[model samples]
Target: MKSSKPIAGRYLGYREADRAAPYARFFNPELAPLAPHVCAALDRGGVPDILLPDIDQATTNLFGGEAVLEDGFVLTSDGGMRVSVRSAMPSVTPAMVDWWFGWHGDAASKYKLWHPQAHVHVGWRETPPAGASGRVLYVGQTSIVDEYIGSDLIRGAIRFVPPATLGFTDKSLDDDQQATIICAQIGLGDAPIDIGYLAHHVRAVPGGSEMRSRFWMGGRHVAGRNLIGGMAAVVAKRVLSVTESDARALLVHCAQEMPHLASFLPELFGEFKDAE
Candidate 1:
């Protein structure tokens, strides 16, 4: 259930910060406001109903091969949907957000640390049941390997909470308002880490959807925490700088596979029009 290996990596040579900083607080504020905006924007447009073929190829290209997903689905008694996808990516990097959003580029690759055999369990149910909560759960394997840390596997879990729970109201929201906020905590097996949190706001645009993720790493101490934390920061910064380009690449790949979605390509890459 938990990683048994000791935290012995060469990257642990750096001195600890003079003062430990506060965790969780860093990401909550910024992401709180942005979640509503993103959800509203997405509502105005629409969530893309991507085909299974598109998803399969996009996932394959995202990891750069050496990955496969198992098929399985389950239904909860509350009429919710539960999907389990097991994947094995031998060349996975430590850029958790980029990996989660399917971003794989030179910048993303620079943060490569280790490969992981991950099994993700996703569960979600619909809303509008009156006072119902819109949430989802994602649990998978976590690991970072280098000459110093070797190869110790860690279990990670993220829970997505509804924006309404955070005091967000649907008043003035568009009739198709499908916007939502996601607050996720990264944990090692059953033990939660205070080093940082993952906040992502996803919205539907004209042609496709847009997702912005902010990872705030404060100060937390766990086994091999410092080493993994440092690597994550490096990777996060690199991915953030090239987010537009990464989004374009992902869309282009999807378009190439599904020609019908090509028309939305321009809209998806609109933000990067000048860059091109």
Candidate 2:
């Protein structure tokens, strides 16, 4: 196995950012050229109204004080890519987030997919019912080529575990402050490829609340890690370009279909609502 140092340096560049406040910036300079394409795709997906009335109040009600929102994308050390728009959902509790993460109900429809009809299979092992840990299969799509037939869905297991699993234990934290760790093991037909870890941190502020997510990816190939890394980067660009649109579509779908999630919306600018 190759050392993950180089990959980590490329993907986890956010660690060098100003951590004093929520920051939004791209990590991989090589991927900078794709930003316009990503934004354009997102525009076509019809962005939702993320800004809603009482959004700050709602975050305060659920998380603690004022809310913080940030948007950006990262190229994983192993070549995978993810674009995220995160904000504090004050009206939604950590338990709620945990539930949503575990729940597979209508998930296939809720999120944008290259293949809407693709079947999704989920299995749980050594996990609680409310806070889940399990494996999910995209059914027909496995390899990179298969992604064109539908989507390059990772054949992996997703687990929602305690922060301690990631070595995050702070005694001075408040009771209302909470954190959730989600990890994924990516592979194909028993052969591991990559791993992803995401940390969801929620804390109470003086008058409201804040939630932040940190995501990282690591290559898992036992050999030819560099070759796999190159291929992954190429695939990441293609996948991320379309996925950005998918994300925007997802937010819009949630706002329209799941009214309960409205509390997290930022006031929608005309451009987002009227996207072509």
Best by lDDT, which number? 2
Q: Write the per-residue lDDT of candidate 2 for residues 70-160, one digit (tens) a residue.
A: 3344333433333333444544444344333443322232221212222233334342322113323222222211111123333343434
Q: Which residue segments of model 1 deviate by more than 4 Å? A: 1-153, 164-178, 218-276
Tens digit of lDDT per residue, candidate 1, span 43-118? 3332222211121233232223454222222222222211212221112221222223221111112112111111
Q: RMSD, model 2, all Cα superposed?
A: 17.0
Q: lDDT of each structure?
A: 0.27, 0.33
| Span of ten consecutive residues with least summed lDDT in model 2 | 23-32
Which candidate tops TM-score? 2
Instruction: Enumerate residue pairs that collide in model 1.
Output: 9-148, 9-149, 10-148, 39-179, 42-204
Question: Clashes in each model (backbone N, CA, C under 3 Å)?
Answer: 5, 14
Clashes of 2: 14
